[model samples]
Target: MSNIVALVVIRVALDRDDQQLRRWERKIAFGYRMFIGLYALAGASTLPVAWLIARASFVSYVQSHLLYPLVLLAVVEGCVEWGLSRLRRGRHTLLIVTGVLLASIAIYFNPRLHAIESILLLPILASVFFLSPKKVWLAGILAMLAECILYWLNPFHGHESGTTPYDLITFIVELVGETVVCHGIIARGAEIWEELRKRGRLETELLVRQIVSEKDAKTDALTGLYNRKSFNEYLEFALRISAETDTPLHLAVIDIDNFKQVNDRHGHLVGDDILRRTARAIEYHLAAGDFLARYGGEEFALIIPEMSHEEAVAHVEKIREKIANIHHAELTTQHATVSIGLCTYVPGEDSQALFQRADQCLYQAKKSGKNRTIAHP
Candidate 1:
C-alpha cells in the first residue's frame, strides 16, 4: 500500500507543474483501482473459510456466512463499477471513497474475523493519500468512532466480553501512529519528487546553454561558418588521421576578387552580405567529406578529403564559377568573383607546408588575372 501510494504521489507531483499531468493522472487512477481490488479480494476470501468450518450445518452456515458474501460481492462490484465510471471522467475522489466504503464492509460483515481493529487503518490510509492533514484527521476520527460503535453493538467480537479502557487507549495510539506514517509517506514523497524535478530542469538548461556557448566559441557569428581557429584545429586533426590511414587530401584558399574595391565603393553591410552569400554558395557545392571555413576577412579555406586529383580540380572550378556568377543590385552592375588556389596533400606533409603551397597558388592566380583558379602540382 505504501509503495503504490508513494509512487502515485511522486509521479503526480513531479508532472503536475509540467504539461504532462493529464497523462499521468491515469497512474493515480490505477493506484486507486489496486486498492479496490485488494479490498474485494480480502472480502471474497471469507467465503471459503466459512464453507470449511464444520461447526454448523451446511444450510445454517450457508445462511449465516455464504449468503452475506454473495450479497456483499454484488454490492462491492456495483460500487466499483460506479467508482470506475467516475474515475474515467477524472473524478479521482470517487475511487478513494469507494475503497473506504468497501474496506469497511469487509471488516463489519465478517464479525467473527480476528484482529478486525487493524482493518480500520485501510480507510485512513486511503484518506491520507490526498496529503491533506485535515482529511486524514477527519478520516481517523470518524473511523475510530465507527469502530467504537461496532464494538458497542457487538460486545462478543473482542477478546473478552467487552473491550477494556486499556484496549481502547492502545487502539487509539496504534491508529494515530499508523495514520501519521501514512501522511508522512505521501508528504515526503511529494518533497522528494519536487527536489528531483527541479534538479532535472536546471541540468537541462545548463546543458543547452553550454552547447550554445561552445558553438559561439567555434563558429563565425555573422556567416555561421567555422572560424579561423576551429578551421586550424580541424585541419591539424584531419592531416594527422589522413597520414596515418593513407587517405588523400586537397586544400584550397579562396579570396574574393576586388573585395576591397567593393567595400570601398559600397559599404561594410554589402561586404558582409557578399561574404555570407559566398559561404552559402560554397556550402551548396561541397561534398560529404568537405570542410569550409571563413579563414580571414575576405578569405575562405576549403578541405576536401578522399577525392581523386581530377575530381578535386573540377569541384574547385565549379565553386569558383558559382561565386563569379553572384549578381547584386546594390553593387550597381559589377559581379563579385572569387580566386582559388588548390593543392593535394603529400603523404607525410605537415599542415603548414600544405597551406603554403595552396597560398602560393592563390598568389599565382592573382598574379595572372583576378577571377581564376591556380592549381599547384
Candidate 2:
C-alpha cells in the first residue's frame, strides 16, 4: 500500500516517459524484495529463544536451522525472489508466503513451543503488505486450516492447553476478524490509490499540454527563437529593469539584405535554411545576458543589457560580419548579408517610441547601404 502511494507520487513528479516510470517501478520492486529478506531475518531471529524453551542447546538449534539463519534466509529470499520474478499472479505469491510461514510454525510445533501461532500472521501481513485483499483472505484461511489440522493431530500435545473447541473457535474468530479488517483496509486503500493515480495522470497530462502550449506561444517555429510577442514582453521587462537598476540596454533590428530575391530564386526551403543559419550566427555572437528573437519574416530583433555603447556596437558589428560571411551549400557560392540598426535605451522611454527609433535607424542603414550597422546617436 505504501509502495503504491510512493509509485503514484514519483510517477506524477518524474514520469515523462514509459522508460522513466519503469525505472522507478523496478526500484520499488527491489525495495519490496529487500523488505521481504529483512522480514525473514527478523522472523528467524526468534528461533534461539524457542530452542532454549524446548530445552535444546543453541548449537543444536543452529545446526537444525542450517548454520545460523543462513539457510532459512536463503530459502525465504529465494522463494520470494522467484515468486516476484517468475510469477506475476498475486495468488501464486500468496501461496508461497503461506507455505513459508506454515513451515516455520510446523518446525517449532511442540508441546513446549509457546506462541508459535503468532507466525501465522506472517502470511496475512505479507498479503497486506502487497495490498491484495483476496490474497489476504486466502492466506488467513490457509493459516487457520493449517493451525486446526496441526493442533488436532499433534502427537506432542494430545488435548493440551489451547486444544479445546472454544479456544479453537476464539483463534478462528481472531484470525477471521484480522483478515477481514486487513481486507477492508486494502480494499479502501485500493480505492484511494485508484483515485490518486487518476488524478496524478490528469494533472500530469494537463501540465504537459500547458508546457507545449507555452512553448508554441513564445517560440518561433522555424528558427526556435523567441516569437515577436515574447520579444515584446521581454523588451518591456528589459526596459523596466534597466531604468530601475540604472543599467544600459541596447535594442537592434536586423534585416536580411536581398531576402526577397533569395526566396524568389533559391526557393523557400533554401530561404528557410538561410534564415535558420542566420539566427544561429547571430545567436553564436551573443552573450549570456543578450536576447534574440524572430521579429518576423526576413527580420530579427535583439536586446542587449549590462553593456556600454561601445561594447554593444562591437557586438552587433561582429554579428553583422558573421552573417555576411556565411556560404550556404544550398546557394552554391552565393551569400547573404544583414543590415542591423541599434539604439541604446533612454531612461523612461516607451517601448513603441524606442522601437520606432530603432526602425528609423534600420531605414537609414537600408538606404545608405545594405550589410551595414547604423546606430542611433
Candidate 3:
C-alpha cells in the first residue's frame, strides 16, 4: 500500500502537463485498483481467524480494533480507487485522509507497545511517493501530532516519565534522521530517472541530425535530386547487382537543348528555374525503381532496372516529349526541349564502360538533332 500510494503521489506532484496526466490516468488507476482488491481480501480473511479464536480478550480486541479499522481502511482504499478511475476531484484529498486514518490506527493499536510513535512511519513513508516534497513533510508532521495527542490523552502518559514531562528528544531525533534518509533516497532516484531521460532525448536528437546530414550529402541542393556523387555510387552498385544476377538494367543521359543560349539571353537565376522545372517534369515520367540524378550543369542521368533496350528508349522518349511540350513564357519564345541517349547493360560490363557508351549515344543524339532519344544498338 505504501509503495503504490507513494508512486502515485510522486507522479501527480511531478506532473506539470495536463495532456500527460490525461494519458497516464488510466494506467495509474490500475495500481490503486490492485491495492484495494488486495486490502479487501486481507480484511475478509481476518474474519475467519476472529471466529476461530475462543479467547474472550482476543475476540474483543479483534472486533473492536482490528476488524473495524480494517473495514475503514478497505473503504478508504475503495474510495481512492474510484476517484482515480474517474479522474475526478478529491483523489488527493482521499489519499491524505487515508494517510491520517492509517497513522491514527497504527498509533492506537501499538502492536509492540514500544514507542507507538514509530508507527508514524506508515503515513510518512507513503506520502513520500507523492509529487510534492511538501506532502511528505506534512504527512510526517500530522502523524507525529496525532501520536502526541493520543499519548497525552492516554492514562499511561505520565506513568512512563514518573512525574516529569515526557522528554521526546530521542524520538524527535530518530524521526528527523529517518525523514532525511527517506528524502535522500527519493532525491537520488529522481536524479537517476532525470539523467536517463536527458540521455535518451540527446541520443534521439543526434540520430535525427545524422539522418538529415546523410540525406543532404546524397542530394543536389539546386534540383533537389540525387547529386553527381550519389549518381555514380548508385550506378556502381546497380551495375554490380546487374552483373551478378544477369538482370536487365538501362541507362540514359539527358541534356537540355539550346541550354547555353537560354543562359546567355537570361540570367543564371532564370536558367536555374528552368532546370529545376525540367528536372521535375522528367522525374514525373519515371516509374518507381528508376533512378534520376543531376549528373552535371544542365545534364541529368537515369537508370531503369528490369527493362530491355527498347523499353529504355521508349521511357527516355516519353520524358523528352514532356520536356519539349513545357511552355515557359518567362524565359524563351520556344518551349524547352531535352535530347536523351539510352542504352542497356551488357553482361559483366563495368559502370564506367556502360556510362561511356550511354554518353556516346547522347553525343550521337545531339549531332542528329535536339528533342529526340537515340538508343545505342
- TM-score to true structure, per model: 0.68, 0.68, 0.69
- Candidate 3 TM-score, C-alpha based: 0.69
Model 1 scores a C-alpha lDDT of: 0.75
* lDDT of candidate model 3 versus the reference: 0.73
Write one digit per residue (lDDT tens) for candidate 2, span 30-122: 544564465457547877676768754766765645453445545655565566566555534534353545344444433345665666665
RMSD of 2: 7.2
Model 3 alpha-carbon miss at residue 292, Å = 2.0
RMSD of each: 7.7, 7.2, 8.1
Model 1: residues >4 Å from true position, as ranges?
1-51, 54-112, 115-200
- The residue ranges of model 2 lying beyond 4 angstroms of the native Cα positions read 1-119, 133-156, 162-188
Candidate 1 at residue 373, lDDT?
A: 88
Winning model by lDDT: 2
lDDT of 1 by residue, 1-377 (tens): 34554455556556665435433334545554565566457545755775577646756666545466546645765665666555545333554455455555555655666676676776677665565565666667766776666666553645664556676678878878877887777688779866887676666556656777899999998899999999999999999889988988899999998889889989999999989999999999999989999998999999999988888999999999988888877786657888999999998788999999999999999989978989875
lDDT of 1 at 128: 52
For residues 14-55, write the lDDT of model 3, one tens digit per residue.
563344445444443454445445544754666677567756
